[model samples]
Target chain A: MFDTSTFIRLLPELILLVTALVVIFVDLYARRRTALGLLPGLSIVGLALSFLAVFAQWGTREVVAQTLAADTFAAFFKMVAAVAVILVVLASVRYMRARTRYVGEFYAFLLVATLAVYIAVSARDLITLYLGLETLSIVSYVLTGFLRDDKRSNEAAIKYFLYGAVASAIMLYGFSLLYGVTGTTDLQEIARRLLNGDVLVNMEWLAWPAIVLVTVGFAFKASLVPFHQWAPDAYEGAPTPVTMFLSTVSKATGFAVMARMFLVAMPALQSSWTALLYGLAVLTMTLGNLIALRQTSVKRMLAYSSIAHAGFILMGLVAVTTALGQPFNGLDGVLMYVVAYAFTNAGAFAVVAAVEDGTGGATLDHFAGLVGRAPFLAAAMLIFLLSLAGVPPLAGFAAKLFVFAPVVRQEYYVLAVVALINAVLAAGYYLKVVKQMFFVEEPERAPFAVARSMRWALWLMIIAVFGVGIFMNWFAFMASQGAAGMLGL
Target chain B: MVPLSWYLTVAALLFVLGLYGVLSRRNAVAILMGVELMLNAVNINLIAFWRYTRPDNVAGLVFAIIVLTVAAAEAAVGLALFIALYRLRETVNVDEIDLLKG
Candidate 1:
């Protein structure tokens, strides 16, 4: 009875696995000079194909024998992950060649990481989730230090590894506690047992520890305040393309897992967890922005800014819990914010990479008079910065508004007001970058040229930022629909 | 049979020791060892829980195995990074690498 049905259901993962192994072989055999060039192309094609396969499974809901779930929520995230990989690959082609030596492994690891994200989103059981998250974390550790000769890269990789390992361990411990209490690892079965109060009444003392440990694990991945010390150093030290991938894809996957676990499986404990999330949201936003203001290095600044944005997303999660006893329409804001962030953050990093390629600069001062030299690059940066600051007529504004509207509806006036204040504080740093780009005089060096590939990615991201910003309603609808599907609404 | 509290207390001690290693050690390799110890503590917890609460469920066992596999992979990559760092900087002192420091 347990034939190839599981493999069939996981067709996308199967294809990706085969492709990753094949890519390794190809990298080993291909000519050294051409390997880097061909490998990214191969990765892009594989990711595209996997995306199509995931789409083919859309609207289908089935438990793949208790380990994985084929559902619309998974399909939606699969599409997002695929798109993120495509963009990262596109942006990486030039950056990797210029900076990194082992391009083959870099591309291969990225593909594997994307596959891990797919698995994480599709996981139906705690074991599968752990396996998937570990896969992603391991590959990312390798990729973070891909520049073997760079000191910064080495340090970043170590810190990331140490933190990630500890977090995973804590998470596993929590999973064990839950298994002890519920006698099941499948999310649905655990939920059923908990709702029936069979486990809750019997093992009430274990619940708080389990919740705290699991929250710590998820918080590390999401880069919440106390656990976020590694993010800035890691982001600044890793290669730019890797930073983009970490901020967007890695962070989004954390949210996906959190939504799946807390919203679906542990809805019974909303009151306890919501308080924790609220504290994290406030601390993450305030600390992230306040520290970012003093940074001179653009990469480090963005790293802190990304942390602040994580806080914003956490606010949406808080809204989802506060508005109702369950995560429902409130999740729409988080989803929309994520989509907007994916575009804007990726675009910002792409522009940073482009500038770095040209001027060998990664500091804010290096961008002085950038507007006079590279108008398009400066313009792209402006759009991304504005969107990030939550300015009107930009995707960021819409996202913030969408999240706050629900909080208002739920009459959480204080939370909404705090979020608004944080948004204003965030503007201070975003504008500093903009001012440096346009107001200062260009240094007396020849202007750097943006690569064709980089230009194409930037243009696409700009269009996405604006398109999502202007048609806010459409995105809100899609996000709400997706959230409903996740909740089985 | 070991009491569940004993297992939990041992796991907790291991985790705290690991945490101390991670925060106090300056050498990257020592820090990695700390991380490994923590991971082992977690594995013990998983097995203990499986035996005590869900004797009928195999998922905890499966998860512990998976966690071991991932820890090994992580160690390989982490050591590679250390090797790379040692080559570049000629030292492994965490405090010395301050290029990206705030």
Candidate 2:
């Protein structure tokens, strides 16, 4: 069943896996100075190749090796994951080095985590998806506490681990229920059986409960409200670069698998799941923003904001449908939003990393006069913040437009309105940082100078934010294609 | 042969019990133990379903085995994290491990 063609479809994952292993071994033996430069460099090269592997498979739409699909949908999310990783690694170089001596292992773990997400989105069945998510969780737990000596980091990791382990176990129970109902672990087979009514009615009722239990897992990963207690602490405690990874790439992975599972395995359960997601969307958006509004710490504020963005992303899933060519077909908005948010959010966190690097804290006092201290960082922070607040001429605006349009089309006017209000609510906090940077008097300190590598990554993120905004129509179309391509459009 | 329903009921009860432990336990290791119990419940559920409905198919068995492996891996990582936390604060009680509150 598996052949050379299948291998090409699997190439991105293979390349990343090998790179992760090689980096670990190389770091073990290489001199410290050489290892530091070589590890990040090797990781970027590996990720760039993986991104190309995904790009090259852009139009190929087929299930490979029975459990993995090499389609545009997976490729789109994988591309987003790859881009997010490369940028984080570049931005991470100096930031991570300062926090820990095991910089090489950090790069290796990052690669492995990326590979896990790639597997997750591409998975066509329950087993592969479960394993992929668990791997990501295990690695993320370690990364969250990478600052082994730091009490806050350790607390965050253990909290994250407890929550994550419980969520995944609960999800596995759901999978077992689905397996029992359909007598199969293949997602497509389960969907077909459910749709065909092959299972007894009592047995059929199992799928609903199964779906609810599984959502608990996805929600924890996405940090939806109620399951989101770990997020703010983790985001506040982890080293800033790891926080960037957790918020952007890791969060995107959660959405990727959730979207693929719903769109692929539970198309028959659309009406039910949509209603469920609609409630979640409202709670996640409202609660996330309300908590964020009062946060004094900028990092904690972003954490809440990211949870709200996940809620916004969930709206696309709620309004999802097969009505191709309709503007804001729900899935496209999810895909577009994931891509746009990854770049914009990572950029915002990078600015956090830069500020925290210099000031040793991300509190308001630390950022009292950021513009005067580090003019370029303050300027970049302005762009990232505006984009996040859904201001026009930026990626966040485009992302919000597509996702919000679908909610309106789906007649979820209440969700749309809550989101719009949340956007405004969210802008209040994002702009708070902007005001602090631009308006506050310059604090007493030496003028800041960002690391050269981080400066380059920041420039790339700025260009992407503008490029994604101006060329939104094209990205929107690509998102449409990716969503449509999953169903063989 | 034990009926599938019997296994299902037992596993579900075990899962709820484990969930209670997770919610009620203060020690991080105890929480990890709670999670292990829940995972074991899932495995029991998987195997029972396989034996009852799809005994000829190895998918269920494979899934159960994989879950077993993953649970071990998760426990390993969880314990390591707890050790690190314990060293820092001299306790595994999660309530005291609160340096990250807003």
Judged by DockQ cut-offs, the docking class of candidate 2 is high
Q: For each candidate, what is the lDDT?
A: 0.84, 0.90
Model 2 lDDT at residue A95: 92
Instruction: Kindly list the per-residue Cα lDDT of model 1 for residues A1-489, writing each as its tens digit.
Output: 466867777888877887788789988999987787688888888998988888777777878866788887777777878888788888988999898677887888888999899889878788888888888988888888888778788888877887888788778778877877787888888778777877834565686788889988888888899999889988988889999999999999888888888887788888788888889988998899899989999888999999999988987777674233343357888888888998899889888888889888789877888998899999999999999998879999888887887778767788778878888888898888899999988779677788887888888898989998999988887787667667777
Off by over 4 Å in 2: none
Q: In angstroms, give how far residue A294 of model 2 lies from its true place.
A: 0.7
Q: What is the DockQ (computed on Cα atoms) for candidate 1?
A: 0.69
CAPRI quality level assigned to candidate 1 from its DockQ score: medium
- Interface root-mean-square deviation, each candidate: 1.7, 0.9
In terms of lDDT, model 1 sits at: 0.84
DockQ, all candidates in order:
0.69, 0.88
Q: Candidate 1: TM of chain A?
A: 0.96
